[model samples]
Target: MSSSIENEYFCDGLTEEIINALAKIKELSVISRASSFYFKNKKTTTKEIIEKLGVATFIGGSVRLSKKKMRITVHMIDTVNDFLFWSETFDRDLEDIFKVQDEISLFIAEKLREYIGHIEIEDKLVEPLNLSINTYREYLKGRYYLMKFDYESTLKSIKIFEEIINEKPNFPNPYLDINQGYAYLGTMGLLPADEAFQIAQPYLKRALELDLSSPRSQLNLSWIECWQNWDLQKAYEHANNALEIQSTDEVYLTISSYLTVEGKLGPAQNYINKALELDPFSAINHHYKGYIYYLQQDYKKAIQFLQKSLTFNSVLPFPPIYIGQSLLLSGKFNEALEYFDGLKGVSLKDLTKLGGKTMSYAFLGDVSKCHIGIRELETYLNTELMGKALTFLVLTNVLLGNYEEAIDYVELAYKNKLPIILLFNTEPILKPIKNHKRFKKIMIQAISDNSNYTPIKRYRHSLLHTEDISKYVKEMEQVMMENKLYLNPNLSLKDLASYIELPTNYVSQLLNQGVNKNFSEYVNTFRLNEFKERVIFDENKNVTIMSIAYDSGFNSKTVFNTFFKKKEGITPNTYLKIKRRN
Candidate 1:
């Protein structure tokens, strides 16, 4: 079910009610409101909707509200065949809104069950809710505001939930909604963590007292336990209790995140997969899945999922941020820079874009530009974004080869318990100093403090072993030479691994240990040789340096010139002049 066009609050409420009604049928696997609502006010294709949600069929409609009347138009789509299986239009007075929603839900459920050959159902699947229309409207408004997820909107939601609680103090749903609103405010960095949690506890306790069976309340409590109290066992217990009542996408995602922080990648993957199965259309779900893959050092798969997440919602900063990081980790430095550059000027307020640009510039060897970004990010340091800003500064320093300063910031992040530091073991930006004694000590301390902490094992084997380094290096070089892989400006570690029939981690290990160089350094060595022989000393001097750089697999003229000067102690043009004069 989807939201209505005219009265988004009412439409969203109706859609959620229908979904909840359908979920009561034990045999049906209903998509959650979080996933289904992702399509609200957006134009999406049927095929895309089906593929993203993993739904066999879907119901879409629009709602129209007049002074005293309501109209709803609905169509059921058979996703497998792209067929409109049923269509209906309803006209009713505003007072009959609940009746209309209930009728519509039951009709759809009956038709769907019949279509699926479950014709002998004994009892009604949907139960009627006992609530006043006015109170229900207030709850809908609260939900509508909560879904916005911004600071002002969350505050507005809280206000509305407070109003509902005042009018009907025993209503558990509004209390739960208030708890969730504060939880989101804190989790999303919209408010001070202490304040948000303080404000949330009373609401949550009231909700649990009102309705102990409510899974959402338990899930909200679980988040508070994990993030605020750092009580992993209590968090797990609450999460499991929520799942016992109802296995919701949000609950699964919550548990998955806890597991992810613990470094239990296998269990994390399983739970996140369950979340995806329940809410496949959710951009957040896909983003996290990509992040998980990134931690696993599966760059190609991570890129694929992150890119898909963008297709679902292009405005999200996470997908682009991680996509650029993944590209950088794969040694596509020029490509990574380009990706970050494309995000510039889209929104000045997006810190993730700034962070990405800062890291990309640093990795591309533009120390000056990187510093400019670092200074810009520093302005956010005292605000609600202190943790994120500090973390980006740490990454920037790492890129600048300032390992000591980076470690200092890492220590600060650890002290602050910044959520970003949770990725200490897997963040590709920290790869340069990952093996350093200081960084390892920080990681060990972090792991020791959290019972859920699981050491990231993606690069464990390659880092621990160094046997047959020469053989691996030889294999890598042979594959590169045979394929002339160095000639491809967009070549990446993953691509090289594919050609060599080796894992990316293995290839990275060979370059770092066996050859005492990184992927970009090794590839640029061949490219520089190619450029000098084929272009600089070529009899035809008419060819341009930039053209030659491109032909020799150097994607950016700036990068080529900088690298060439660094290696040869002269600019490319100067080297050419000196060679010709000699």
Candidate 2:
């Protein structure tokens, strides 16, 4: 009843007489002959068709004519119970096709009406949710794309969902609606962490409010919180809640793998196995199973499962990355390099680069290049532009003997108030710096909000020459002053590179050779020193926190507070008050 029977199926190839007669059926919920026939000869089962059509009973038939006579055969099956309740065969002339279909349809409807009236089937058939038929179709398409798990195809699904919502804004299908945004955020990693969460939260919240009966929204939110914010407690509750409501979802357990990596193996294993049963073809599911073994430090088993994942979707990045990571931990650096070599030029994004570059440098024993890789990762972290990528950098930095740099990133985790230890423990790249005293101390302080780097390749292209270096830096500083921009905010080597019209890597090289400071600490040192001087010497106290923050070129109040606390060990307000008292 939600969709006009005419809109229910594709009857494109059927004769007009047949289409019109089928359309006239008063009782048969005959999906329009055009729409129902769309699946002709396609290998879909009765259950799948019933689910797709949103109908409890489906009536199908075939017609044949021989020796100038026509015969019709029709069967009506109870899809939910998989039983053929009624069937009939009619013999007639080919010209009587329309009459046969109409008569059969009328007869079936009258019989159903009588059966429902007598047995009260109408009382039990809960009316379908208030969803536009078009939106529901789009949602099914979105689910189809999600099942495929390829990046490009998944993105296409998101675009369809966007179009669906645009077409019908008030449609109550919130779970299907907001899932597109979550996919966008997860895929693009465009917004900063807090900003990303803000974008995704409304859809998830609305989904919960609209349908306590649907678990997909809650399940997605739980994973995002776990992976993006490291909020395990909330993740556990949401994930468990979803499984309680719908026990068949595979992703419900995949989120638990993060907890497993933090040494909660039993729950992790339980969820991973359940997810596999629900969707056995998912390469990602297999990768997680392998990841669980790696978490238990069981390298051999990890290798086996990860390899199996490759057979299903050879292009999937994590299984290869994890295999490489386990290889590194097992001291098979050379073998790890072989793995990373295969991953180059694949669309593994920033985080994969961290793992691939780390293993490559470590296996080759190129300590200086390893540090260079770590510096590049530092540039990524201070920007906080990408979470999965930043996670990669945090571990890689520790691996390359740059625990001091790890301090800078952990400062970010603390500012977000995320549990840094949990992440640090599971991330194989940080295996090198796990025990450093300064790193541990900073992790405990819960101070410091690190700024992120913005990628600007246009700026990087201009500074390939030595002469351009001074000009580039001077122009950048001038732009900061011209705009009164905060020097301490999420400025990356690329931003400076973009400012001067040079390449990012070139600017990094110039800074290393000319300025002798890596991208982040170099910028932070300038900001911190300026902050200290302004508090002590700017006596008129006309510099309100917001004014000074802008003058210093900081972007947000949160970033300013975090930077101030980490650099000076006091809140900005308290620091200002103490300075004034003195």
Angstrom error at residue 477, model 1? 75
| Whole-model lDDT per candidate | 0.75, 0.57
Candidate 1: give its CA RMSD in angstroms. Answer: 24.2
Runs of candidate 2 exceeding 4 Å displacement? 1-133, 147-151, 172-184, 187-191, 224-231, 251-255, 382-385, 416-422, 428-582
Identify the leading candidate in terms of lDDT: 1
Angstrom error at residue 489, model 1:
69
Clashes of each: 3, 26
The residue-by-residue lDDT of candidate 1 on 524-548, one tens digit each, is: 8999999988875556588888888
Cα-based lDDT at residue 233, candidate 2? 62
